[model samples]
Each structure stands twice: as C-alpha cells, then as structure tokens.
Target: MSNLQAKIKTDSWINATWSEYIQITENSDYQKAKFYYNKGKFRIEMSPLGNDHASDHNIITYAINLYAVVKGINLNGKDNCTYRKTGYQDAQPDLSYYIEDTVDAVPYGTSIISLDEFSPPTLVVEIANSSLADDKGEKKNLYEDLQVKEYWIIDVNKLEIIAFAIENEGSHRIRESQVLPKLEIALLEEAIRKTRQTNHSKVGLWLLEQFQK
Candidate 1:
C-alpha cells in the first residue's frame, strides 16, 4: 500500500482479509483498541473506557474471585486476554474465566491464546459502558461460535448484567450463572450499584457477607 493508499485509521474492515485485520490491530494507532474478528469481517472497538467502566470491571473481577474462594471453587480469571482461532475468528474479552474443573485450561506464560490449540474460556465478560450494542449482537455471536460456556455483558450505564448460556453453537439469555452455581446475578448487580456510593473495599466486604449467607 502506498502513502495515500495506506489504511486510514477509520478504514472499513468489512472486506478486509484476516491478514489485513491482524496488521491493523498491530498498528500503533490502535494500541488500546479491542479487536474482534469473525467470519470475514473485523470490528475495532475504540470506545474510550470511562471511569465507571473500569470500576465495574475491577469490582466484578474481585467479586468473582472472592466468591470462588468463599465457595471453595477452583477457577482462574484473565483481564483483556486475547483468544484467537487463527484465520477464522478472534476475540479479546475484557475479562474471562476458566471455572472449576477447567481452572488450568490454558497453560502458564502463553500469549495470544490460539483457540485452535486450547479450549475456550468457560466464561467471558465485556464491560459495556459504550459498546453494549456490539457486545450484545456481533460479539455474542463470536463467543457463541467459539463455544464459550457463558458470556456476560455488564452494562455500566444501566447498572445491569446481560448473561447468556451457550450451547450447540447457539446461546440464550440467562439470569444466573450455569458454571458457578449458587452465584446470583442479582447480588452482583447490587454490588455494582453500591460501588456508585462507596469504594471497592466496602463493596467487597459487603459481597463477602452476602456470599457467606
């Protein structure tokens, strides 16, 4: 590609090949952009993550970890992890988890997890302050086709969580987690609401009390 013909920052990804998608994601301009490539198209998520988004991301992460510990469940979680299926599909979930019986799903020190080699995460989460639409539609299809057990989108603006259960290459809305039994979605949402009024330390303490009950 020549100087004038160079791929612009806002270039369309619809007709771009998988190699082109990878090249664009590697560009310095999109260092913070989350990437999702499925079928023949790619979507660059350049939404500026706001303070609320980051707060919910952190709280949910901590809450899940605390819940697992309190319940004696085996699980591992990742933030901003990339899972790629080579030329076919790729997803960079904001947070992902390998639940009990699959805590060691991916080996240590591996970068850019290749879905062709390893199993998909048991749970995937997208903190959706601004990207809720794509997170619910296109990204949902990506995770479903990737065969993740559960997918969640935390709507920061609405203080709501939209969970889904994936099976047979399809998904359906869910109210509670199928992988982490006894974990109430409502309680997590409640904790998210409390974060607006208090710090994570206090929110976390309250969560601990709730989980133990």
Candidate 2:
C-alpha cells in the first residue's frame, strides 16, 4: 500500500468522489476496499466495512483461492465490478470465479457483462460473520436475480456453510455439497480452523488437492 493508497483507505466515505472511485476501480491495490464504498456503474447495495468480521473474511478468501487453484479455475478473488443483470449492481463476493472457458468466451476489454454473457462459476462463496442477515436476505436475492449457478455462505459464528443453487428462472434453493461435491465438508471445516491459526494457503492447498482428485 503506497502513501496515496493509505490515504485513500483512511479517507472517510463522505470525502469520496467519482474521480477517486474511478482511480480506485482502475487500481488493483484498492479493489476490495474500493468496492466497500462504491459500486461504480452497479446499483446494488453493499454492507459497510464493519459489517463483516475480519476473521470470517480471511477464511472465506482462503477457501475461494484454494478451490480455484485446485480446480484450475481463474478465480478473481475480490475484484469488485458492476454487472448488468435486470439492473446494474456492484458486487464483491468474498470469492468469485470465472472459469478459464468463460474468460475466453468474453470479448477483450468488455467491462459490464450479463449473467447470460458468460458461463457462471461452479460456485460463489460469501462469509457471513457480521452481515448474516444481509447475506441471507438482500445479497441472496441479488445472486438469485443474477442467476449465479451456485452460492455458498459461511457462517463464522456457527462454523457452517450454507450453499444455494439456482433452481428455476427466478428462484434459488439451498443445498449441501451440490456445487463442489468433491470438496469434503470436513476439509472446509479444517480450512476454517487453519485460517484462524495460520495463513489461508493451507486451506488453499487442501482444496487444490480435492480439485486434483
């Protein structure tokens, strides 16, 4: 984080400007933090920074990276962008993946794309430590509307994973082990434990092995 980046991070939300939003959007360092405040062209609402517990955030991020590497999927970990669904909404899933095939299908330099525009991920993961209600409510509705193939919510306090999948045109139904059947629930539990004791890479490697299997 450079001095400028540090300043931007510390700056209050009231001082934010469109130029600052644009600059942060273009820069890689501030992607997650940037999306924390603005949605750019997207109209979706995001929970405030303090809404999510830090520990839960770290665990979810690790799990996503691990799953991506294991599956050879191009997971854009926390790169927030506006997607044009029925309406535009900005979302920063704790982890979101655009498989290699999906990326190859998109035209280069295209920013806003629709759910129909590309292949949906095998799964999308969110950690609900502080934003449990929002994750289960508004965010869930948003993902359903966008027609994401699968969604996972990690409840930090309960130490459980809630997974959902699109069942119909506008409906999403919750399921266990539906998205990544190969991934053992035990492994996710272990990953969450390791994330508390060490870096997320341990969980990442564990998930990579599952994908390799």
Candidate 3:
C-alpha cells in the first residue's frame, strides 16, 4: 500500500486521528470520494457509482420532494452535503433534510455544516447499493451518535427501505417517519419498486395519486 492507503483504507473504517482524517480527505486524490468519520475512525468510499446506484438515488430524491410538496410540509433537501462536527464526527449522506420548523436550520451560504453552530439534520438517508453492510452497520451508528431525528437506508438490490427514528443518541426501526409525520416507509419502498418496471414519470403520477389521498 502507498503511504496514503496504508494510513487509510478505502470502503472500510480504519483507526486514525481527526487530523489524519482531515489530511486524507483534503488530498486531491479523493476529491470525488465520500468521507465519514466517527469515534476516532473514518471511512473513505471510493467506489464509482454504477447505473443502479444513480437511478435509485434520483428516484428517492424525487419521491421525498414530491411528498413534501404535496403534503405542504416545508422541506429542504441536501444531496451529498458534508456535515461536520469539528474534530469528532463527519458525514456526507446521500440525502438529508431539514423539515417543517427546522427547514432553515443550516441557513443559506453555509458550507460543510458545523454541528456546533447548527443542529444535525432532522433526517438523513443513505442509498445502499454495494455499501449495504457498512451503511447498515457503522454508518447507522454514526448517525445515531450525530443525533439526527431519522435515518434511512435504501437497499437498491432489495428495493427496500430500512428506516429508523432516532432519539437519546439511539435509534429504533419505524414504519412511518416521525419527522415528516405521515410519510410511510413502505410507500417509499413501493415507489422504488415501481421505478424498476416503469419510468419515473409513471411512478411519480402514481405517487401523486397516493399522496393526494
């Protein structure tokens, strides 16, 4: 392994100081990679996203926005937004949101949201294609520690959503969103499944019908 890879392995968590983690992430070599840090270890996900990953990412983004709009819930969605808790923890979740009363929690012009200044996002989501295990394991723990109100893992292979409602630095499985109110986990899973058999517009129309009820 090169000096960099020796210090930090890609796709797996490794023990490192916060300074070491920052050095690795700042290097130009990993500009496009996703980074996560928690409890003195960090993960570098360098795997290039494939077609399946991209498709699911877009569809889920659409479904959440559509639902929020139809339900008249004030929402702000973040795509691959880096959230940092200074020397302690960091995450760039696939998707995140500030809902209703907290829609403007991070304010405009903020970069690499500082948890010291702003509360962690009310909801965080990771679309898990090849990284299902890590997303379910270490990453889930990371979000729990961050104290996000909700966390979701979309398993592309299974076309399923595994969601949790977080509190008191812990989490438990939940079928409906506590932050977004009546949004159901199974409904989102159904939307993902429909995307496999039809185009997004058709599925979107179906969602509109469902959300309108």
Candidate 4:
C-alpha cells in the first residue's frame, strides 16, 4: 500500500500538510473520493455508493433544478465540483449552485475553482448518510470560512434538510433559503419523504406541481 493510504484513513480527518493532502488526493486510489482540507487537517471521504445515499442526492439535485427552472431563476449547478483556496482550503461539495448574477462567475474552461479569483457559490450542499455529524459541525464551519452564502446538509436517514445562511464568518439556521429566495427547507424534506414511498420520477412530478404553484 502507498504511504498515503497507510498513514491516513478514509472518511475521517487526518493531520497533514497541504502538499501531502494534494499528493494523496491526486493518487489514483482516491479518484472517486470527496476531499476536504481545512486548518491543517484533511478528510478523504470514500464516495458513498449505497442506494439510499444516491437516491437522496439525485432527488435533491432534481428538486433544486426544477425549482430554479420553474421560478425562472438562472443558475449553474455543479455536482461534486472542487473549490480551492490554494494552500488555505479545499472542498468538494456534493452539490453547489451559482445563482442569478453569479451564474457565469466560473468560466467554461475552469478546472478546480480558485476562490481567490472568483466568489464562492451562492449555495452549497452535502448529502449526509454516514458523515452527518462531521457535515453539521466541522464542514459547516469550513463553509462559513469559505464565505458560502448558504449551506445545507441533507440527512438521508431522516429525509431532512438542515440549512443555514452564512455571513460575516458565522451562520444561523434558516427555514427558507436566502440565496434561493423563498425555497422552503420543509418542502424539500417533504419531497424526500415522498421518495421513500415512490420513485424519483413521481417525486419529481410532485416537485413540479409545488414549484409551479
């Protein structure tokens, strides 16, 4: 096994230098992992492949896109995209959105988004199945530091969304999204609950009706 794999465990934070983190992430073994680096610590999340995790992730993405489209809000949605502040921080959120005027902030050919050159996404989301506590705690603080306008954690087991509006290096829990303009956290939770009883196609149709009304 490689030294990186020997010294570090996946799905948990490990103390490492920024350069070591980069090297481990670039190694082929972690090609599909989600990565986070903050405050001299880095976490390599082995991508969750369970059906429950993926189902919730798909529905949330569908709901957001459906809401944005029906509401005529211009947006660019990114799935598992990387955002970096060079040596300072790096995050690969499960889902993120650049909304309204910032929809085009990231140009077409950009690779890992450089936070120093561009503004952070208006919204960031993490789909939590096994990493719920980390998502709600350390990851939440990391997003605040990155100045993400809004952060959300979707708990797959509970079919719930805990959202926060972030500002001035702090955050407060919010029911209605400030970034997405009146998008209701409870509504999304309801949609996720519906998915437990039906397929995503039917849940998506339900979301369409809700967004239209």
Clashes of each: 0, 2, 0, 0
Model 1: lDDT of residue 49: 85
| Cα lDDT of model 2 by residue, 1-213, tens digit | 245455552223323444554455577554445243222321222336453356666666666566766666564533344444322334556666554445454455866545456554445667676566767766777677566767777888777777777656354455445554455565676667666666656666665665576
TM-score of each: 0.94, 0.59, 0.96, 0.96
Residues 1-213 of candidate 4 have per-residue lDDT tens digits of 256568888888888889988988889978888899998899999855699988888999999999999989999999999999989799999999999989999999999999999999999999998999999998998999999999999999888999999999999999999878889999999999999899999989999999888
Q: Estimate candidate 4's RMSD in Å.
A: 1.6
Ranking by TM-score: 3, 4, 1, 2
For model 3, name the residue pairs that clash: none
**Where does the lowest 10-residue lDDT sum fall in candidate 3?**
1-10
lDDT of 1 at 67: 93
Across 35-110, the per-residue lDDT of candidate 3 in tens digits comes to 9999899999999889889999998899899999998999999999999999999999999999988898887888
Of the two candidates 1 and 4, the one with more favorable lDDT, higher being better, is: 4
Q: Looking at model 3, how many pairs of residues clash?
A: 0
- Give, for candidate 1, the lowest lDDT window spanning 10 residues: 4-13
Off by over 4 Å in 3: 1-5
Worst 10 residues of 2 by lDDT: 36-45
